[model samples]
Target: MLTIEQATYDAIVAHAKRDHPDEACGIVAGPEGSDRPERFVEMVNAAGSPTFYEFDSTDLLHLYQEMDRADEEPVVIYHSHTATEAYPSRTDIGLAMEPNAHYVLVSTREHGNNDGPVEFRSYRIVEGEVTEEPVSVVDAFPR
Candidate 1:
């Protein structure tokens, strides 16, 4: 199962809410350990609609450089689903680059109306094949 901290989950939800009516994409950065996954918002260029999502290479390059400087690699890649369910679309499978990296999806269907309750899930895309896994969001900070 994929694990995430409260902050990371909050960030992703905020990003998805910010990009409502369209898809938002980003990357999750963290150490190899499973303590706290530091998720970052990479630029996502909408395919002129909510049905499609394309990562902005220009922004991705900047993120890559930042990660390189930090001596860290991308642990997971994230994108939001505006209209459809939080499942891997055909295009998502086609654009799978790192099979090892977790593919995170935020579902804004019926739930995420406006700052709504969003569902988070993780997936693995290898060799044009999609394998989904469960995600558990643990609150890093106990109240």
Candidate 2:
């Protein structure tokens, strides 16, 4: 399972909508835990299209430094699909670098005016297979 904060979730959604007509990508930062994972957004980049995602290495380096300073290793890499479901594409399957790291995809389809079902989903890309995982986002304040 993967746990993400509500603010981070909103950020991802916003990024997705903002970059609609193209794909949006970013890094998910937080301390990894068995449950109640504390995750947040580190950066956002615009991917060219459904076929390719361009991650700025400099941005990644910056995120790495920040994570290192916070003693938090990157546990997830997230992106969005503007016209499809929250599932890994062929390119995504081919580019799965960290098998253990969580892969999150936000589907912006049907999300006109930013008022669509929160299509936040998690997966693990291992050996070309994208395995779905459970995910939850914590509110800003505990209920």
Best by TM-score: 1
Q: What RMSD does model 1 have?
A: 2.7
User: What does candidate 2 score on TM?
Assistant: 0.80
Error of 1 at 78 (Å): 0.9
Backbone clash tally (model 1): 0
For residues 1-143, what per-residue lDDT tens digits would candidate 1 score against the true structure? 67777778888888887887788888887654433357565566646468888876677888888877876677778888987888988889888887668899988876554855887889888998888898787877343
Candidate 1 overall Cα lDDT vs. reference? 0.77
Q: lDDT tens string, model 2, 8-117?
A: 77877787777776778877655644333355564545356754577877877777888788877667788878777889889888988877688989887787336667
Q: Candidate 2: how many backbone clashes?
A: 0
Output the TM-score of candidate 1.
0.86
